[model samples]
Target chain A: MAALVIAEHNNQTLNEQTAKTVTAAALVSTPVHVLVAGENCKAVAEAAAKIAGVEKVLLADNALYARMLAENMETLILSVAEKYDAILAPASTSGKNYLPRVAAKLDVPQISEILKVVSADTFERPIYAGNAIQTVQSPAGKKIITVRTTGFKAAAEGGSAVIENLAATADAGLSKFDSEALSKSERPELTSAKIVISGGRGLGSAENFKLIDKIADRLHAAVGASRAAVDAGYVPNDYQVGQTGKIVAPNLYLAVGISGAIQHLAGMKDSKVIAAINKDEESPIFQVADFGLAADLFQALPELDQELAKRGY
Target chain B: MGSDNSMKVLVPVKRVVDFNVKVRVKSDQSGIDLANVKMSMNPFDEIAVEEAVRLKEKGKVKEIVAISIGPAQAAETIRTALAMGADRGILVKTDGEVEPLVVAKILKAICEAEKPDLVFTGKQAIDDDSNQTGQMLAALLGWGQGTFAHSLELTDASAKVAREIDGGLQTVELKLPAVVTTDLRLNEPRYASLPNIMKAKKKPLEEKTPADYGVDATPRLKVLKVSEPPKRGPGIKVKSVSELLDKLKEAGAI
Candidate 1:
């Protein structure tokens, strides 16, 4: 019995999180199999099969899996629970939705957002939004966990695993999908972007957010916002980056005018190079930033963009 | 579950370190120091309580019940919920700590007995930040759930909620006996007036233990250690954008 990593995808392409989850699963066992559960998702299954260290790929194409209703996903996972020693998923929104249902149906406690794999049974996860780390050991009948994809490297694309179709399961009829309103954007997804440029309350008004966008456009970076900026209506709620918002670990994170609150710091502190440009030198963001510039973002955005443009960015 | 005042809402709250206080790791790194530290209701749970109270004020809800599972002092958190207009409180007393899985199990047991039409809780407790109880509870009961809800509209038999997801807002509809967890923008909690505080003192608070509900409060995971996060090195004060760009290039982060 090997570990099963549930792949997160949109039926067309595989999400990067699935590879990171595979990296974690490979740590637990050698024969890692990925489950792609969606409607007309053979492309995603093929993508999962090519990931390094994946020995097998299980494909479950059914209309019940459309939009991934938790009940339907749970039913599908439980049908094959007896074959795997461990069940894991990337701690994405969809993963959080269905993994708990799988764990509940299995009567086993789930380990959420593990940061380190100490052993087959022991793992480490951040509690209180990375304020403290708690190492835990779960010796249940089966291991059910969610890997924090940011903590692990992604598996490479070289393996030639076999893709097998799985039998469908019955629907529980417990829940139904209504409709969803997603933000349509041409910019890269925030979680997987390499460079993230964020603005804060110091930007002043919603119109002032254009300054953050200008730098992002020049650098081809994704734009994010501090909680204060979103709370002040400088941007939409989806732009927020904090403990309660999206956590991004990028190669370069540029903070403009954001006096980094502890909650805000928790989200982007994992970046490789953190750069901050704020008028206040005492901003906590400066403490974590790799490069600190004491200046007004209103004046600095254009200056930085000009510098980047001159460099043929 | 209905649009009228006969609907009953069950709201669960937790006692956590107050949001204003900075938590410090113990010298030995055993855990965070709670001695002499300020503890209050989780802010997100306060939003949950406020949302429930607003429904009551609009004549959409008839009763609101609050519950807390922790040491005896957790009654204070439930008292705050009562002061916010919850009709009653339940204190599930325990000497040791309980994880989210057991908390959900105990809550499910209580829900079975109370038979409330709806359940509301914070998306995650600021202390653990696990964000599991609501989803786990809904799973245990085999019910629908809408988590991280921003705006909620109630129909005659179902609820449509605009949830704050990863990249944008997602609207979901769930049938009766559903679980909903509150996010930051759901609603602002009101100040507990002096009269309500006094009234909360006389509110009926039932006391029970996990054993009473056939739930074992034993921990499943053994905590090997607790340590403070690694601190980043002191940043270089770059004089100009060129210096910043050069540093980023040297670090291979550009």
Candidate 2:
């Protein structure tokens, strides 16, 4: 049986995580089909059809699915659930919101944030804030899973798959959309950036967080914050990177003034190059960091920014 | 908003390994070592209890019932909720590892019997972090779900919840009798006072089992192994910022 992967996207652009999820879906079963459910999202559907491993694209364009609300998305997924044996989605905020509803309605257990596709029925996931890796086997039936995008390589765009139009499911009328205050930043998004620089409570006041910001801007990287830094109001909740916050696996992750708690390390330990600058030499972050610099961030940040400038960065 | 309105709320809490304690994997790769670890109410569930209590304080709610689906010790977690101002408690006692789907099924049965106007649960427990129960419960009940809510405003007919999304906040309005999952920044949970803790002991706590609800709490997923994650290699400490930059350059990280 084929696997169905729900595509993650805004109405305009396809999120790269959808491509990564397609990779995981293919590993679960062959002939993966991508489902794009949104309003006026034909371009996103077209993009999903080009993903290498996808065999088909299921497009359900309607006003009810514009925001991909849980009630509406669950109804839509279940309408076509009979054709697939495995259902998969990226563990994004939207995916987390709706996938379980489909899983419960289908009477199956949903695995959240799997890191590896061990087999058709077995998978690996992190628990206890990524302190442990657990391998689990799903029962024989429909498999429901949310893929952690950082754990898999993205399926390259080359193949041309057929697009099939799916009818919209009836709206549950259980919820209504009001408004959104999305953070508008000129910098790259934290989860998708190749380079990320994060600050912690050791940065002191919110004003001092500018030091981390300047370095991030110079490096053309996204800005992140530890849970303490966010809870201390040094940054907004969106900037937080931890177990409860965003999980990022960038190429280079430089944590400044951040004493890595296990929860904080859970979000970024998968980065290719891990570095830290903390005054405390015995911080737990150093255990996972490939490069550790024990220096006061206030003095070191400015010097580092200047040195980068000297190098024409 | 009237005084006679039956605005009852239900909050579900879980007992988890304390957040401050570092969790260690067992030597046999069976699971986490829980032999001597201190356990506390899951932090996000504490936030849910606090939110429900705040609603009751504002006269928007009349009664609060806290529930847990775990061992008898989970009643201690419910006691913490009662001390935080919940009116009663229910313990769905099970000694095994009950996954989110089974917990949702059990909660669905309780909702049918209790008929709460609102159901609040933590977004995810820190132990398993499956993040599926609330949404699954909502599905079984055919109710709206506001997941990851940081701010919530309730009315007679609906609730306006500002959720913490990936990039920022998104507000949605869900009809009454809906399920809402609490996230961080919803509100700061208050410490239980000595008097309140003493008062909570007398609160009604009814114990039941998954069998009582006619829900099979059997394990659907089999655990193959539980092992420690791969450890990074030991790193050298750089004495100066210049050396740090040089090392990063050599590592092709700059």
Q: Which is the leading candidate under TM-score?
A: 2
- Per-prediction DockQ scores? 0.73, 0.88
User: Cα deviation in Å at residue B167, candidate 1?
Assistant: 2.6
- In the range B14-70, model 2's lDDT, one tens digit per residue, is 999999998999999989999989999999999999999988888789899999999
| lDDT scores in order | 0.88, 0.93
For A42-77, candidate 1 gives per-residue lDDT tens digits of: 999999999999999999998888777777788899
Task: Find the candidate with the highest DockQ and give its number.
Answer: 2
TM-score of each: 0.98, 0.98
Once fitted onto the true fold, the runs of candidate 2 whose alpha carbons sit more than 4 angstroms away are: B1-5
Superposed model 1: Cα runs more than 4 Å off: B1-3
Please give, for residues B150-182, the per-residue lDDT of candidate 1 as tens digits.
999876788787888776777877888889989
- Residue A187, model 1: lDDT of 77
DockQ of 1: 0.73
